[model samples]
Target: MSMDINEVPSVDPKEEPHAAPPRGNLRKYDPLDMESASFSTHHGQAAKATDWMTILQLAFQSIGVVYGDIGTSPLYVYSSTFTDGIKHKDDILGVLSLILYTITLLPLIKYVFIVLRANDNGDGGTFALYSLICRYAKVGMLPSQQAEDAEVSNYQLDLPNNRFRRASRVKSTLENSKFAKYLLLFITLLGTSMVIGDGVLTPCISVLSAVGGITQATSAMTEGRVVWVSVGILICLFVVQRFGTDKVGYSFAPIITIWFLFIGGIGIFNFVNYDPSVAKAFNPKYIIDYFRRNKKDAWISLGGIVLAITGTEAMFADLGHFNVRSIQISMCTVTFPSIILAYMGQASYLRTHMEDVGETFYKSIPGPLYWPMFVVAVMAAIIASQAMISGTFAIIQQSLSLGCFPLVKIVHTSPKHEGQVYIPEINYLLMLACVAVTVGFRTTQKIGNAYGIAVVFVMTLTSALLVLIMILIWKTHIALIIGYVIIFCSVELLYLSSVLYKFVDGGYLPLAFAAILMVVMYVWNYVYRKKYTYELDNKVSPHKLKEIADNLNFHRIPGIALFYSELVQGIPPIFKHYVANVPSLHSVLVFVSIKSLPISKVPQDERFLFCRVEPRELAVFRCVVRYGYKDFHERDSFQEILVDRLKEFIREEQWISPPTISSNGDVNGNAMDNGEVTNEEEEIRRKEIVGREIELVETEYNAGVVHLLGENEVVASQGSNIGKRILIDYAFNFLRRNLRQRDEVFDIPHKRLLKVGMTYEL
Candidate 1:
């Protein structure tokens, strides 16, 4: 039943699973009969589940979650370039070069290369990147790197007695790493802000712009109703947040899937109609020609030109779910080539048919009904905002689990769906912000003012962070990256300049909102870190396991008890709470502490450590679970296995007395052997009433007994008859303090102050 200290367990697939039986019901324990804890039936190559198919699904889902913001760029890009064509043409060419470069370079190349690689798993986004980087601070990355000290593990394991070798070895990585914690905090704050900004901005811009497109198509829809319609659409969008993506997400994937095809089809039709030379939009020349023909409006054009890159952040955000290879394949095969053809096709259509203008060019397609397209486009935008909001919620969910946010209610949408998250408070906050944006802005024309600033701010920060990560992580030189980022930042700055000019025009609000959000994220993290992370840390005893093993007579649980620890202790201190509190002595199991090793090698066998706490079935045990980024999940982990084993051990042990009910509601408490209330204690309580934790002399609420049993304390709170109390008090105090001038009896500070003022002291 005990593991040998000299032998190392294999982490290999061939190793059989070790099962711990429950003390009571054997059925409760998982029959770990498998040779190894491998879950490869659904993964890896033998499963026949190609990464490409998953990648494609992930890519299409990204479009559902991400495409609208980027997809709508067609509304303004060609227009921006067209209007700019009337001005200085030289800078236009440069700007055009910049646009092509941003599209091709950022979304296509750099995002696919550097940013997506940082995904925690299939959840790529700013928050994912934040998590990836913050692991240093999260796992005490910096302290582990530099410090001699070790943080302790909070959880205890239920493995049968054995000297844990592999577990101890792996659990040594983040012993005292403070850098991981700090870096995680910093990155989380940044990511939370960007996510929140995107959440609010997405619905406002996406739906409003689609409405703009729709209104242009249909003349009956009035301008004043635009705000109302936009607000309604936003409310509907926020309402769907609770349901999770599995419900409405399927519809969007199909719609967006069709939308892309429609875009391709339209491009083909227009290409056949216009100067086939327009096929050169992909050549990066027409984008050049627009600027060449006119340059005076380069800054303004650049402002609108940035819209095309709206989904650029989304591309990076989704790097986790799909392989980089698949995203590139989609871009090359479906998204990119199609996008170029469409834009060129649209531009070509405009070139020849300027005089023969239809009400909306989007509507002029030959065979189909255009109104439905507008509606679907609106749905796409709603989905876009939904994706942003969902991403925000997901980030906050992870952030909260990491102890970075105030506990907001998080209701998971599906047991099987990891990404199906819903946070009501966030949804409402974003909804309110979005609806306000709709009401205040009125149209996409005004909404655009609130748009570009977010991209510039986030992208600027992203580029800056990338440079840092690349320099620090990849050990690449930062100078060249700094120069390139600076150039892009400067370009972004000029774009922001145009946006700022539109502040009075409606842009200042989102900037203000984003700033407030950033501050909130920082404040939330700062307050929690300062107030809580260290609260339990110092309270726990460091030298606990050896002491527990030495003190056999010490009271403990009958079976294994696993308490999740933030601390990295050999024997978690929570077990000490039991020794000090419980009268029974049984066995103890501490996981010791978990840590990752420098080597990325997967061990031949998985169980890290096995150690004896005491003797036989009454013994204490320990295990240390190690995991990597790809290894994160709610289920399927060494820690979860430990929980299962602990439960099993507890059930199998008969030392644990069955829950015996008292006449009064009580569980764990200091009591007499017979469990009878002592009248002598009642007398002592009346005598000792003068002393209490919180003194309640008299209150609006009933002054019930603030009970104090030795280890436990609670207020027996009762409501006061506020009406009768206030009425009588007000009359009595008025008569005594006001009429009779007995100010002390009045007991109202302001009234007493007024009397003093009336006394006219020099």
Candidate 2:
């Protein structure tokens, strides 16, 4: 049977109803604690501009954070494209034509117009797209998803029944085929890894290219000095990342704004003075003519020509920080026109002075403005690097939330900006890699070769994923989908092929980085799945719990204990192992499961879900806390919020039922009939019982609270093959030991925490 798109089963329900009243077990709390808890039905939607002033402000801020990388492309595109020297003035127009068409088609039309609309509740990037697909289908491998996850504000999608029927078929094919699922995951990871690679290369190339202009300004500075100077600037740039993007954007907005104006003004000057004839490059015919005349040389030159759109992917990846309209406004108004003007000016300059092709940007500058523009160019380059670095952090955060990457310490740097994050581990590693690449490559040409490969590969993967999204999520028409694939994918593939040709000449660098990152991501996800599956198979059942309680001399202690596990439905096997080793149990037990949903933020009112486990007299309950990938959890407040919610649940349950006597003179805990009891008397009795239960919960909570965490050791099964041993015993274990642990992630107080050791052979 096919499931409706909205009917895909959640891993576990928010609340399960009970048919019977609670047994008179004074030691146990009320069984209907979850029934009265509030669950907000509010659906998350993308942020929108409410007024023109806000839109204008966001657009201004976006120029720094969103357009930095693409805006700075004017610095090197002309020089990189004509690395072999311009043979004819027409070659300049041909390359300019290619640049114009690429920016217009890819960034302006494809991403801003179409792909931006595909964002997952304002969140974008390869992982966000994958997240949307996962939500619509049962393709996600993670086992901890909860039914409450779909209720997250941004997780809801409204589709007509007819569209859903078509989407369901697409979803069915992916769910039924294991290979297809893996392929989709692999493609997403490949794109994510490339974006991470972009993080490293962007800083190296941008700073290096901008700093290289020093040699043109003064003959005194050598290439070696330029490399060191670039390294120093990169170190400073990465160091300031801890201040977060909000501050960075505020500071950078003016520099990038001025830089764009300067470049555009210079382009206009050069166009009028040298060659207004270069304006013919705006025509698409020149693109065909340029390739027709140059043939092999033109095809190879595309490797460098592709650099013009290096930062286009950032527009989508960083969409979580700024709304679509603001980004679109920034791009069309300031970014697009300025870049076009800058390139036109460079082409005009190159038309007259072909020999200056080596230092096109610096040489074209008027003598009076040379030093001033150079300073702005370097700062602008740093801003461009900032965009990619921020994008890398965002994608990695998404990957970690989905369990594809190993756990790392993620610090949400801005309380106001949900997407502004700082990852210390990734930041330092990227710094080292960027500095190393800058020092080693020492020139924009070689670094540009590597940069093009990463950029096009990510773009091509995006196009491929977008095709599936159109079919499965958007339910776009077959004809429109076909046209999209043909136009965007064809252009991306052309660039991909060209960049691949330079594999031996520095293109291998990003691919090597991507390969290592991809393996790390895949292995972490693989081991995570195996470990979860083992837990699921070996989970402790209610009957098993009864047996353990009866035979193991189990005795209830005087405090509340929270047992943390990955499972959402049943008691984790680690709890059984803990009981086997230690016979005593806490007076109240809560199986706490924390999960990250794919959306950007879970509403505060809907963050916690309470469910009562069976045999409620044992005082056992389950609490599931859900967070969006962008949500920040305050370590100290968790205990307080949980306690407050539990108390509220207790008070609510008392009012739901009032004490009543049966014919045999037993307290049946049912409502009293109007004739049997006065309304005032019943109200007093209800308040008394409610007060008693509330006092009991508070006393027990004050006694003590302990956090129980599982410290699991995963290994290949005894009879497993060599491949499993290598992956599980060596690779997975090494990463698990080196990366962040569960205790650290949750930030549980060390004095109140207990570790339960268990072994999983999977």
Candidate 3:
């Protein structure tokens, strides 16, 4: 059996490797050993865990929805290079070759090859990177997230005390934690915020870009109502999102596959038409010629080239949700080749009609095929926008989880599917923001004018942090730093520079927004850290500790006392007071606190806390709570655990504290919400957040800390209303514990679940 009462084994969804301790070393706590160091400095353990599918699914979904923009740029690349407006000397083959390189190197090589590989505990994006650094990186001066589980303790929650009934309910509550829900909500909100910008821009730009694309296919319909058609299609696209992605999503992968084939086919047809020279683009001579021969027009060419690489940042940020390997597979297999071919095809068509400035390009694909292609283009564009939208949610959760932001409400959207999550307040606000962005931008050209920079800035931030992770945390030699820094920073900088070139052309807007977001998140997180880290109790009193040891049953197991402490040197404030009252302390006591890590992997030397602070029988047992960044926290969990260890610690002189009564005059207990605490439950919530209530609070009147040590060995069933005090503690052998719980089992109601309408992958 698992050692901790709060430890729930993984289920089918347990397919994701949890951040729990290994079976052999799970630690349970005891409160009776006042001098026992249960939670202090101990970190000697080593184990590695992997779950590639969960990693990929999460990464893909996060960025696929919002980052799809960069993913589908292939739709335009093939044609853009061939169009007469580009003024390139390359034939179809040359254009095709160039397109191949662009797709391969920029998106695949720079991001997936390097950037995407750096994950913050399977969390991605710039902020996730920030959190990882703050927590574990030993970079000369960076602070870490060694703070308490403020979100849990900050909010006031009442735990019931019908003894057996309450313990049973609390066990169930602790087993199903709350981290996952909060994370989903936070990330979803952030993604939606970005999409509000994309929703408007994508409609105007993607459709218009495709319409402009038609002008590259052939020359028949360039003079007519392209604007009207584009606008009409965009309207329909926006309306469809309300229905959700489930039905549409079933066909998403296949449809995209077919679209890839269509893209390659068009490229091949154009290649055959002119048998274009592959060597032309490679010379660097043509690029020089274009600049020297037409210096005035080169800026526009640069702008167009820059557009080709705009979505790469989203590619990296979304990699965590889509696992690096799957992204590599998907891109190499379908997304990449098609993009290259499409670009080549567009280039080939442009070569055939050298005299035409975009006129012949549109006229080339002269049939009903344009409508289907148009729909595909719109669908792909929406997919791109959605990827970023979803990423926002993931980003927020990660940020909050790593202490970048305060707590917010998180709601799980899927029953069994861990990835299907939704946030209503976040959703409605995102919709409003997305619609506003779509209407505000009004054109892809305009949106494009401002896009690319926010992500690049994020990319820059990530690269800087990655350098810190690789060199400092990983402890690589200086020899590797040059090559790593040179290659990573160079590519990121080149793209960022391109984005910078467009700053005046409207790029500053995104950078400005990114800055604002960073500030707000940083401030909230900082405030919460300080508040939660403050003295948990202003003072620990001897009187309270005295009454606690006097009031309960002692177990036969090895007696242990576990208390958390701030500094390793001094005794815990509570313990100082605890020993004064109990007089007789346990044989061994423990002090504990989490030794957080960026990777969260336990090292070989830091697992168990065994130190002789005093002597053989009297020692301080300490432990450092080491777990994954994605795990959640629970309350009263450790206390119930001592109940079992009481059975194990048969020789120690550990005494128990009586369960305290609430100020409301009732024995209160219970979890405020449902479900296990995944990142979904442990939203990167801030401590200073108002409104939400803490689970437990110590007021002036109810000034005692209650500790329960298992099935009641003694009976002090009721308090006679006044000044009389009883001195006898009886073992309640007649009080049937199992019978009371069995009767209450059917009394609890199941949680009701409602869907937020999220399945539109179609």
Quote each prediction's TM-score. Answer: 0.62, 0.91, 0.58
lDDT of 2 at 424: 89
Cα lDDT of model 2 by residue, 360-417, tens digit? 9999999999999999999999999988898999899888878899888888877766
- The model with the greatest lDDT is 2
Q: What is candidate 3's local distance difference test score? A: 0.43
Question: lDDT (CA) for every model shown?
Answer: 0.49, 0.82, 0.43
Model 3 off-target regions past 4 Å? 1-67, 75-84, 87-100, 135-204, 207-251, 283-285, 294-300, 354-368, 412-421, 474-480, 533-762
Residue clash pairs of candidate 2:
44-153, 44-154
543-645 in candidate 1: lDDT tens per residue? 4444544666666433333333323323323445545655454333343333332211112123232332322323444434443222232232433455444
- Candidate 1: RMSD to truth: 16.7
Candidate 3 Cα deviation (angstroms), residue 252: 2.1
Q: What is the Å distance of residue 566 in model 3 from its true position?
A: 14
